[model samples]
Target: MRNMLPAAITAIMSLSVLAACGTAGNESGKPADSGNSSTAPAASSAAGAGGNASIKGKVTFLTNRTDMVDKEYKEYAKRFKEKYPNAEIEFEAVRDYDKTLKVRISSGDFPDIVLVPTIPNADLPKYFAPLDDLGLNDKIYFKDYKATGGKTYGIASGASTVGIVYNKKAFQAAGITAIPKTLDELYAAMDKLKAKGIVPLASNFKDKWPLQSWVYDLPPAIAGTANVANDRIKSDAPYTLDGAYAKSFGILKNLHQKGYLEPDINSTNWEQSKKDVASGKFAMYLLGNWVINQVIENGAKSEDIGFFPMPYDNSGKINSPLNPDWFYAVNKNSKNAETAKAFVKWMIEDSGFDKFAGFIPVLKDKQPELAQLTEFKSFNPTFIEGVPDNDQAIATQNKAQIDPPAMVQDFVLGDGKAVFDKFNKQWADAKKSLGY
Candidate 1:
């Protein structure tokens, strides 16, 4: 594993010069070129201009999250209402989204607008509407979501970049300055903090997905490159496992053996994990930009925290992968497709919505009210910044496994563990209670 860091650099995604208007990376924490309209055509098309009339319809929103405190979908509905007065928004929140959606869609009680966290399945035509024919996919160059050029299903609603969120206060206490650039340095710092009795990685395996990220996150190693995310998805191919991923998991297993994770990762839930980390129980955690908003809501000072990309290698290159991570889809049987589409369009291009939403918009030219109080901008490092590698292959493997269907739902509710329990339960379908 001595050459692990250097040799792996040639395996990660190559750095692309990020422009505000360019669509290069997946949900990687790269800076985009900025400047565009303040509003969408339905609302803030040219800024400071109001449309004369509003269209009306009742659009049902099928969502994975049911938490009103989160306010992501509600912010969407509110902005949509402001833009279109005549439209009525009815939201149907699914507590156990996987089981619920399948049953409801089967029953034919479909919503007008639907939001999918990530659909690993490429056969979206059987489920969602083709945005290409609708003309939405025509003008936009999305990094993922293509079966055929003409059969584009949905456009991603909000994009959030994932990074290693570390507490500055925690770093200062250890008298260790600077974010770790290599795996060895990261572990060394973690050991230092551990000696001081501080947990290194605040983790909750009860949710399962967060930790599963260790398995799915590093495709550059498995795919042998980082840029081919979409190609792998479009191909009728089998999953492959090897390389950098092998090294990455070996690292995770060592962490588990070293007790760097929680006391019992199998039982640690996300709620307790988040509380512990925010209270400084852990030194660092791999978090998405969504955690920024969560921190604010939880009463943490923005300056007390900082974020950086996860660097698996020693050369200080940041992994900026462009993933269609959080996607919103329109129901194929929606009577309010036009209104639903209008709402989605407005959310992406609207500065007002972006300010509150705190996510990167998918539109080419957008006026994003991004927070500058954070150092995330200078923090965008390309793993290719120092190493050279064609990352397209890695990107392809990423898109394929990162959002696999069997992986997502099964782990979320312990369905995965149940199904994997015994050969006798092998044929048992991953089904939910009628109440869920």
Candidate 2:
């Protein structure tokens, strides 16, 4: 689930104010030589407010989206250099980036500006530099997503909401009159779809990560609160049959029990399921708004694909989980601190990353033109506020070490009560090992 999984960091933050630092250049505009000398930014005294700060040094940017690297980010760099021409940006891709980043963090070998991962709110200060000092709070949206004690350490390029991606034509074919707004209504719609010989939901259990939608994505809508996940982490038996965790999982269990899921769920994969929904073989799938374009690109008619908030409660007021894919964080130990900070400021304030990245713009009055996101907003979904989970608490499951998705997959295979029981014990053990 990209929603909660720790992610790679993003760009921009300038160097500290220097009195008389000189502009330095390397052969071929590469990173300057680190001669164990002063690592402060080379800001010229001639530069003042609104004037270009002479920053020269290599800032390494690590990202998981190599596609964006050659396309969108290449443009971002060109615009960035318009101000600090001396700065050189070196790009690197760490495969399985989120997991590899953890290894790099443990080894003290992380890059200068990482695409900041879901490193949990409690651990933000340990790995990132606070951006509030740069006055980012008043400038950026969702500043509180990664803040603690009034210090903002991470800022997102954009935001996304977890919702159900469905085929609009399929609902019309099933003679369904309205979109579901509650768990009971969703089940009722499923019954209508099933009656007309259509799969009500697509569960890509073989890949497993998609199953995390039920665990982490759906519950916030059900509880009408974003704190459900963090709250469960602090609860005694998070997987009990009657708990909120179960209530959310209960939605999946009900789908399986009622024969509303796609056939042979355990063997299904995400790619084929995308086509299935496109072809009207499946009606809906639980995922973030990001998947809407992908589904359309996979040959689903763009107009036929619509997104709605996940309705897990009868409150008639559903809350879509708002998630920032990754935040741009400056590495505190970097030699080019001022330049890095400058880069961050440029990215947050000047770069048109939202349009290029196709995300919900986090800037004030800056709205996205993506129809899926616009459709989601039409529902007037409620937003939730909660603390970010520390790596120690969130890592075990997100890594698929304990594999909550696999457990849900087992529930699909059979014997859900046993699986929930086992999960409760394991979850408690994992949390206890972290002394919480």
Candidate 3:
């Protein structure tokens, strides 16, 4: 992951203008605007072939952003239609995206363009079309995440980093003068906040999914390597007392055991937690920077919210995982593949959707201008890009029936070391059975 950052940085420094427009050629040796002209004539060929073909067809897009379907998405479709008068873009938004999409995929009723779900990387070719012809392989971050056999499948929509989204007003009210730089300092600040009757951290533990921040997201930072998941594949005893999993889970255990979390852990509400955290009832959330805008939208003043890397340990040096969010891909069976590919390109390059969604842009040449990201960078922390999990890694996890978030919930309720030991046994047995 570190190896990829320097090249991306060089690309960013060399760009005088954003790659959204102009004649700059990407790593594929094709111009950024090659097939993106609004007035170009429509072509019957797919857009992946050098991206010179103008797209015109009816294409269906499946998105998890149900909140934006009516307003923002409508505008996107309208603007896309204006660019290609003969084309039509339809969005099918689902509230339970992963579950619904999985069923749809099994029934062969999926849309043209869809967000890639939690599926094995090796199965990418079976469901999604190769996007190599789009000419974005080297131009975009996480280009290799869904690629196989030299053909790329999914293109990441955007990226985000894990951090502490805190309320500045709450911090001031608690008399905390500085941002916590170490685990001990963080605990001290949380104590101060707790004394002031603030829920020091909103552990949305009941939601199950948000708990992934500790197990899935923060482990990479704690291990100081993007290859944490891959590394686990090589060892049967991945969950040890001294390993990253134990340390990451240990922090959550400490938070819960010390009464620093919400009053009602099991009955916590995700939506209301946002409102509570925004209003300063909850002082902080160890979450991604993506939540900052949502918190502000929930009623917090924009200036009242601040972001910083989670000081998981007393290292005095911070490392955060710069991970990609959902990936956008074209359905392999789509009849309107060209239009789908064209829409994906437009969404990634011209739509400005990443900014609207408060995400770091996926294009290496385009740097995020978000205020929270600026504040996060102010600490001079190292940004570790995430590595994609291989097939064996995913298989081992599934075989062991290891759900990190569920394990965390159990850890909070029971013994942390015992939970880790149980999972370690299961993982070792699974690995031996699979002959890994």
**Candidate 3 Cα deviation (angstroms), residue 375:** 1.3
Error of 2 at 419 (Å): 2.7
Q: TM-score of model 3 relative to the true fold?
A: 0.85
RMSD of 1: 9.2
Error of 1 at 133 (Å): 7.6
**TM-score of structure candidate 1:** 0.68
Query: What's the distance in Å from true for residue 340, model 1?
Result: 1.7
Flag the better candidate by lDDT, 1 or 2.
2
lDDT of 3 at 254: 95
lDDT of 1 by residue, 1-436 (tens): 0001122222322221122312211112222323433423522321214342434678877765454324555555665577677776767776546445656665767787776433334445666665443334433435244333456556665544556777677777776687787777888888777877778887555565565345444544334344333333233332222334335555655666687777676677665565566666776776555555444444445556566676676765656433333456767777766666665555455423333434544553343334521345466554321111113333333332233323333333343334234211221211111111
Give lDDT for model 2: 0.66
Native-referenced Cα lDDT, model 3: 0.77
Candidate of highest lDDT: 3
Local error of candidate 2 at residue 114 (angstroms) = 2.5
Q: Rate the local accuracy (lDDT) of all candidates.
A: 0.50, 0.66, 0.77
lDDT, model 3, position 168: 98
Q: How would you encode candidate 3's per-residue C-alpha lDDT over 170-285 as one tens digit per residue?
A: 99999999999999999999999999999999999987778878876788889888788778878878877888877888898899889999987999988799899989999999
